[model samples]
Target: MHYALNVYGADINPLAVLISRVRTARKVEFAIGAIGASVVKRARADRRFGIETTLANRDKWFRLEVLTELSKLRRAIRSCEELWARRFLWVTLAETVRLTSNDRTSTYKLHARPKHEIDGRNVSPIDVFSDLVSRNADSFAFFRKKLRDANAVSHARYRASTDIALVDNRESKKCWADVAPFDLMMTSPPYGDNQTTVTYGQHSYLPLNWIDLADIDPKVDTELLRTTQEIDRRSLGGRDPVSNEEEERLFAASTTLKNFAEALPDTPSDGHIRLVRFYRDFQASLEAMIGQMRQNSYMIWTVGNRNIAGKQVPTDTVLSELMEHAKCSTVTMLTRRIHHKRMPDRNASSATMREEKILLLRKR
Candidate 1:
């Protein structure tokens, strides 16, 4: 699918996505085979990176071809100045790779390396690269449109161009150091761990595997790619919280989460742990955001009630408690019907996010 560049305004940073890849322990591999040490060194030195030779579940030749094609494309684009915009374009190519890969099956997530597979009709890497080049201008065009709008606003309001700052926010708990306080802070935190809800890590795995980390942003640490799920795990609730007493106290702070946890129907221990893990980190991140905002500044949270252990987790109510705990008062809570939203339909925990809630809060 094409990006939401001109439509719903999905406003994603490819660097963040790529940086998430870097944050993981997973490193990109070159096409499988003994290209030996020199190629590996070259792959690292050059931004036109390689793929994991150990990567399984795809046509070997096809993977190599894509890698080769990608190398040439990177060299061809070396003269381009629109780094971020071009990274998005490369992401489009990465998407094409996913859509063309044998992994493009009926699975709910892309990480499932299928078993007992056979070759079928697939687009060659060259063909995909050709198609990508034709539409490359569109990527730059979208960025240029945004640039013009930004410049126009600056000229009218301030009589000069404005500087853009790209901060690395892959870490939720860590404080942004020496930052000026904000008049407003608006964000939509994840409903749950990406695993049970969305396979965001898996979605980026392929793209990250193919694109050069340097091409996207040199700051994008490939160390994040230690594992396919590293970013997801690094996310809220991705890990075990502190002491049990602390977890219990934090968990008990939100009656909504506590009640939801209590209502869990015949769940496994991991399911219960996952729920706790999410809200604890969610709580921590919320607290950090509040600390960054000016007193009396407004904050808005648009959250979804994701199903966990077959129970609906009232994220809005939970967040209201969190905001109150963090010295913010909930001004209002509203619900909006979700006529359109993407989710794993077959996923038992997430098949029921048919609506979302909007929570407005004022920092006291």
Candidate 2:
């Protein structure tokens, strides 16, 4: 909507898709402030004491008092008549959960705070939710004002089209085919597998338990919340094992990948296996994306070179080679320094990247 262009996006994470959908929604709720105030008011007046989540060991991550308050908030949000407003409030509730939970805030992983610290801390989910709702309402109002000023809004709705879907890119050809072909593609794919890299699934696991799965997408499976790692396992390169033939084809398509694999130790280590599997899945996703682009279309890919077994994976070079094999030519490569990041400086397996490469390519 910022550029007033029709936009479409897909993500494996349901939470991600929910957030993206709200952000790109064509319809605007001009009464967002009123709706948010009503939610808080209803939550405060309700006296329900039931916990809402069925997540295993729920007490491990939340105190009884906090859980009770969250349950009240959840029920109140559910009473909302407007689906869009409810979705927005759900996001607010999710943020409140992040702040009030026993989980530490420094990292994406769901490690609990020290027992002493958790006990010493006094937080209220209701208060947090109220404040977030107020602040977010103001921010959204400001954004809509800007859009209106730019003539991007008409009759309280975005002028252009927008579509967001919950999808696995490796198998998304049909999804993209449902819409017109795109001329420009831009994405910053995962640096490596989520488990050893960022654990996006784990980051979303807690908040997801609180939000209604049905509100996100009809196809969203509750099984994704079965385990902390379930969503990550369903993500790219998470559970699929690379076959020898597929590996050979991938190697033939990108010599940089072949060289990297050949340089690893003869003894097949878990890290080596993960590296290859991630690339294999990435290749498939790239093919699916390329298939959706129009001829002479341009792609801007931002990639990071992650380390495995103390060796750097030349992701940018490898991606360029793969695109070349798919009949695309690299227009240029640009480097950008990472000034700030949510990832840890280093993990047990490897150091996080300090910079990233942006490759611009065109379909021939």
Candidate 3:
């Protein structure tokens, strides 16, 4: 068996780069799976790219098969798009509301909706659903025609065709863990043990119910397990410690949490210790991520500081120190005055925070 090396030379086409990267990513995944070992821990211990080599010989065949299947899946998603988009509208709106309360913060009173309201403009859930549902109809025929016309100038087939490479690893930690070193790492780490900024489980329920997106069962990811542990404080509407309620509606389990906490003598009485534990846990995860990165890789982390007991715990500053301690070189710290779309409403007396400090760290 022979393999063709994908290289972008001086006569480069943008599409070629995308297709080549997609193909390379797929081959890498097959290689990792074929290794039959924990690639992550192994990668940390020893940088190995052999699995990628073994799969490259059959890369072309695999790419063609996967793309054909993806085209069909895309068609199916388009077929039921109307209902899919409509249902996604609520889910998208719910996503705008960041569910922040941990199981320990649950209360019996009406939960105050955060002040942050999201603007759903042109690509609203309704529009997405409508376009998807009417894929076969002539309604979007003009748009489709225009798209095809715009894409026709290229002589590239594989170059112009972009693909998503999904590798199924039974021992992966996060959703995109197997995805090799990305050119850019832009993401927000989980905030504390509370689900306040957004309950990953709750916000995703709408998308899961309506859209035909890939299997993103949060339960499948071990990183999400930490979230489940945070929300598993008390049983809802029952005396038992466990309840069979879905994770998305775990906020409704707040009342049950307050009851459980009130019953405990060492529940910190003021909720300060919980913050400590949460931040500490977050720092640990960040360290693990640092360990996984290639040397000199950049990490963009966006986090905010909230008022707790009238003392501002500058998580950004604390995290900076932690990152440096973890051997991550401190790059420029960028402070942006962006509003937390889910910033909670504060009383006249409570201290309010309205900005996030973006930290850029480089792994050494």
Candidate 4:
């Protein structure tokens, strides 16, 4: 059994104990993806279902198997209510619809800025939901009701479980406003300036602003406040310039980032600086994360090597380097090929990133 498990690990990227601990959640997510993929494939195959075919063969086959397995894995996820899965499925279905749509209305138009080229048109949430309904009306109806009930139950539970008192620290000036013990920790840190795709500042703005859990208290100290505020500002539109001739030289020397920079138009000064600062901050976040975990705690992150300027910026490798510098141990690194369905080659000329490494680490 041990030999078999080790071989499986080798095939999938060596699985660390930390990652193995979350096998259940990973399995559930895999199952869900499988089921969702199958539904989409079957729908596309039967044009009578009105679902258009937008996925490549690789994606279509992957989704069919993963999504179908998800349908079967529904029985195994602990503490997972049917409603949660249903809601997730509905959301995924909506995404699939958007992915397959031929209309261009949904694509983001950056004024003179880089835009992600997708298939024909922008697909809407409604369109996806409609597709789901047409294809699986019975399942659709079940999830709809289940989602409503789940929200109600979640709200009640949050109101009833008052173990950790909420303290506002929005305005706080401290290295970390508060430190709380976590049961498990998983994160995919930024690879580097050139390799990362998801902008942390832009991606997190709405959630940080709207969610009460992230509310800042007025009593925060000045230093911490300024630091966080600067971060927020950079996220919005701030960019930090590369500090010296040395740093600029380093960036220029990077085969990965140079390509990305050349491919991308000159970013607004503020935005450019923010990207650099964001990576620096990401490293800090990793360090802080390691510090916060208890001894022997687990950390699993999904990262990858991004291609920039015809060279690869292995984010997984960079992060491992950072973790080691912070005195953390490298547990395992799993390389996986995930055909991102949403990443479309509109121009058919831009470099595409097709694979990612799932890095698993442990804090000793």
Top candidate when judged by lDDT against the true structure: 2
* TM-score list, all predictions: 0.73, 0.96, 0.44, 0.42
Q: Per-residue lDDT of 269-318 in model 3, one digit per residue for the tens?
A: 44534554454345445655565567888888897665544445566766
lDDT at 19 for candidate 2?
87
Poorly placed runs, candidate 1 (over 4 Å)? 1-67, 78-88, 105-108, 111-118, 129-136, 139-143, 146-179
Off by over 4 Å in 2: 266-268, 348-350
lDDT of 1: 0.58
Candidate 4 lDDT, tens digit per residue, 181-200? 44356655443442134333
9-81 in candidate 2: lDDT tens per residue? 9999999998887788899687888888988898899897989999798888998889999999999999988
Which has the greatest TM-score?
2
As for lDDT, the candidate ahead, 3 or 4, is 4
The Cα error of candidate 3 at residue 358, in Å, is: 0.9
Q: Candidate 2 has which clashing residue pairs, if any?
A: none
Flag the better candidate by TM-score, 2 or 3.
2
